[model samples]
Target: MKRLSVEICVCTKCVMNGAMDIIEAVEGLKKLKTQLRLNSQVDIVTRSFCSGADVCPLVCVNGERMEHSNSETVMAKIISLTSKDVK
Candidate 1:
């Protein structure tokens, strides 16, 4: 099973834009974890120095940045990363 590390910010702008819900989306990845047989270890954190604030509400899976994403987009990224045979 592959491990995934996710990072997010808790800035107010992000919150207003539904960044909090992003956390829920990350949690939702647990379902994919089971289906993909991958260990979905999500780290929902706040980085004061994150320059992505301009992009605000950023979601990164395994060091790859996903931009302007909603919950579903975030989930897709996780599934893509965790799936063993996806090309």
Candidate 2:
């Protein structure tokens, strides 16, 4: 399957801005995906310092980066990736 790699910045600045909330939201969605048996594509998540320090709480979905990301915005982007992309 084609993996959707999501990288969230958890640096001090991002954490202060609520990066953890985004992480938890993604995890919740992941659980739901499993329950729904949407097992075609997979998500690989990671945490790191901000590559764009000016844009704290950043999220990267499939190499597309977004600044000032929140749980809802990140969730939308991830869920928009269709399962048909599974390899």
Candidate 3:
């Protein structure tokens, strides 16, 4: 199975923006992996801060930076990336 690493910036500013929501959404997604037919394993990591603090909430999927990230966008990315290997 493939492993997808998701990093979320949880600095005070990030958290204030919406990082917590993204984290929660990701965790919920992990729980529904089987139901979603996800073929990859998701690893969620919370980091203290990232260089792109100006953007506040930031997420990286497999090292691909996503600035100004939100729960919907982040979850969609995870699903889209993992769905490529579904077949």
Candidate 4:
């Protein structure tokens, strides 16, 4: 399996939109790492502002954007992005 790296952009606007939870959602991806037995590294950054501020709480898995409003969707996106067979 290819090593996975995840990047999350959390802006102030996103914070107002509940970006903290989104951050947690990305952290949650760690569970999948252990379960999938895949060597993966996830990095989540909370920036004051992102160019995608309009899409605050934006999640990018290996440079792909995953849009959503909740943790479940975030997790699903992460899984799809990192999974060897999915992307």
Candidate 5:
């Protein structure tokens, strides 16, 4: 199973832009994926700050950075990345 690495910025700028909510969403997605028996694991990490303060919330998935991240968009990116591994 491939492990998906996720990073969420928790800087003041990020939280002010709803980064906390994104964390919750990612947790929810992790639980849902586990319940569904998906063959991959989501490993989420929190960051104190990133260079994307201007963009506020920044998310990184599989080493790729996403600017102006949001729950829906981040979730979609994860879904797309995981589904690509399905037979």
Candidate 6:
């Protein structure tokens, strides 16, 4: 299976801006990946700080930065990335 990295910023401002919610949602996605039968494995990581504080809720998927990110957008990105390699 392919591996994907997902990083979430947990800085003070980010946490206040709903980082926890995003984390939970992403975790749910990881748990459901097997059921979804995707060809990718998700690795969720937390960063203490991210330069994009102005855009509090930040997410990075496979080293690609995403600002103003929410659970929906993040999940969509993951699905899209995995689907690309599906056969």
> In terms of TM-score, which candidate is strongest?
3
lDDT of 5 by residue, 1-87 (tens): 799999999998899999999999989998888554556789999987587457769999998988899999999888888878875
- Tell me how far the alpha carbon of residue 84 in candidate 6 is from the true structure, in angstroms, after superposition: 0.7
TM-score per candidate, chains pooled: 0.72, 0.78, 0.92, 0.65, 0.88, 0.89
Worst 10 residues of 2 by lDDT: 35-44
Q: Clashing pairs in model 5?
A: none
List model 4 lDDT by residue over 1-87, tens digit each: 455555556666667776788777677667667685545566665555357546766666666765545576777765765675543
Candidate 3 — which pairs collide?
none
Off by over 4 Å in 6: none
Q: Give the whole-model CA lDDT for all candidates, comma-separated.
A: 0.65, 0.76, 0.90, 0.63, 0.86, 0.85
lDDT of 6 by residue, 10-80 (tens): 99888988888988987898788777667888888998757645987988999998888888898899888
lDDT assessment of candidate 2: 0.76
Query: For residues 1-76, what per-residue lDDT tens digits would candidate 2 score against the true structure?
Result: 5567788888888888888898898888877875544543546566775764689888888889989999999888
Instruction: Give each model's clash number.
Output: 1, 1, 0, 0, 0, 0
Candidate 3 RMSD to the correct structure: 1.2
> Is candidate 1 or 6 superior in TM-score?
6
Cα error of candidate 2 at position 35, Å: 7.0
- Candidate 3 deviant stretches above 4 angstroms: none
Q: Ten-residue segment with the worst summed lDDT in candidate 1? A: 44-53
Error of 6 at 65 (Å): 0.6
Model 5 scores a C-alpha lDDT of: 0.86
The reply for model 4, stretches above 4 Å from the true place, is 1-3, 85-87
Q: Candidate 1, after superposition: displacement of residue 57 in Å?
A: 1.7
